[model samples]
Target: MAVYTELKPEAFARVSEAYGLGPVQEVVTIPEGSINTNHRIRTPEGRLFLRHTTVRSAEDLRFEAALLTHLTESHFPSPTLLLTKQGRPFLELEGGRVSLFKWLAGEELRRPQLTPDHLERLGLELGKMHRITQSFGGSRDNPYSAGQVRSWLAGLRRHKDDEVATVAEELEEHLERAEGQRGQGLEPRGVIHADLFMDNVKWLADRVGAFFDFEMACKDSYGLDVAITLNAWCFDNGAYLPELCRTFIRGYQDARPLAAVERENLFGHALFGAVRYSASRIRDFHLSPLPPEQLTRKDFRTYLARARALDALGPAGFLALLGL
Candidate 1:
């Protein structure tokens, strides 16, 4: 769905030789997600994922490769970054960066099929991943920072279009409230998967096969990742499933217990997560130049509704859902 460039056999052959991956037998394009081209490469040596992206800088791609390597070193379930003969994780080709990675075997779980058991596992895996990533020496600043949100809102205001104005108004209200409460409690900082939405996770049987797509990996408050996961995974039919959220927290606590600060700030962080997704979705769907078909636009309604609902629930109600 995100293939923006045509791939040729000759290019694959060059990559194979450069990486010593053996002769490339065939290449199949895998249509999933928006942004970046993904292809499944078959070789006599082994199966691998060949991903190409022009939108990100070479530095960003290299940072992602390093993050993936770090995660693998921590005994986490993530794809190993395949190195070139020159000992680099990516190849510069045709105005984009292409990287080969060991293909992970699993199916992506959708919301309808998700259960508390699944959330428990997701929580446990995320907890372990967070704990492991604490020692990662590399760091990337969050691309979706509060400042970025404010700038996006400013862009919307300049347009003067009715829809853009309405979205900007609503988003500003949420952002104002969420930003105002940032210091109610102290949140511990660490490496986090800033975009750990459901589609990014893969499952094999009952275990997490791998957490792919480290494109948005960055350093932030650890609670932000927890909040983002709960926002994405523990919701159904335009509402947050309180019991499911509780179960997820239970699983996370079993691995790494939440600090008092985390529990105190959970609701605010969740609201921040909701606002983040909603604002981005609006920018992508309404304001961005990319066509609807070329890029996937998640419905902004879900996150907006969740943000409003969480506002009504208040801190006590939100904490109570997690059995605090």
Candidate 2:
């Protein structure tokens, strides 16, 4: 869960006043993603979402605000920025960046069920997202790239705990193997959601309520995007349901079919996906001076389970199960 650095009402009120919004009433903190402090605002106008970003991304709010506006205009159900009395998209609040959005209608679904219909729609919407992709929404490369992974691991070797350090070292080795395989090109590039876990997908009835958290959105591999979704949506403990992977992938492939190479690379991409989450969790659990909630709890458990499975069956055996 996101750990909010709570601001005094008076401090937050300064922002409210900037946009001439609200006879401010309540500020209720919502627990979800990292990097932002979000509060549900109850005011004379109506309920709204107030997001205070503690971490900055390559793109500023203007682009995301525009992106949301773009998605909304496309008839996608995303939360758009709300205009204040003065018609500003955001109110620069308390020394930090702050913004408001209309509160989306949503009911969080824990253990989200993956029915055939849901997968089909998800694939369609994801493809729809790609149709509206932008090239320069952000000015920096994504931190999840091969180079960044190496840089982080190099830094981690300094102060990580044994478990974290071991994972970091393993990350180093896998990354080297990945580099050796570099004659193999990455998948074709385009703007991808880059973060499409179950949490980012909201459910309102059978319809996808909205896709929130556009912060990590980036220009990256289409295959990587698929891997991100599968890593998040497919496995439960530490195994792959090729059927589930097939379902989501076929759903995507129906939009734009995967190349034979990408299909063959699926196993490696799957492992890449796992290591991404694993590294992020280890980094956050050790780094992040402002402790933010990550998937570390689930990640290490997944790691241990995968390790046990590997030990029981051996590497060749595990790959055999993956159909690699």
Alpha-carbon RMSD, each predicted model? 1.9, 4.0
lDDT tens per residue, model 1, 130-227 = 89888888888999998898888888766768876787778788887887756565677888987888878899987788898888888898888998
Best by TM-score: 1
Total backbone clashes of model 1? Answer: 0
User: What shift in Å separates residue 260 of candidate 1 from its native position after superposition?
Assistant: 1.1
Tens digits of per-residue lDDT for model 2, 165-237? 7767776666564444322555666667778877788878876788877777666666667767766666666
**Cα lDDT of model 1 overall?**
0.83
Question: In order, what lDDT does every prediction score?
Answer: 0.83, 0.64
Q: Once superposed on the true structure, which residue ranges of model 2 sit more than 4 Å away at CA? A: 57-59, 83-89, 134-140, 179-183, 286-324
Clashing pairs in 2: none
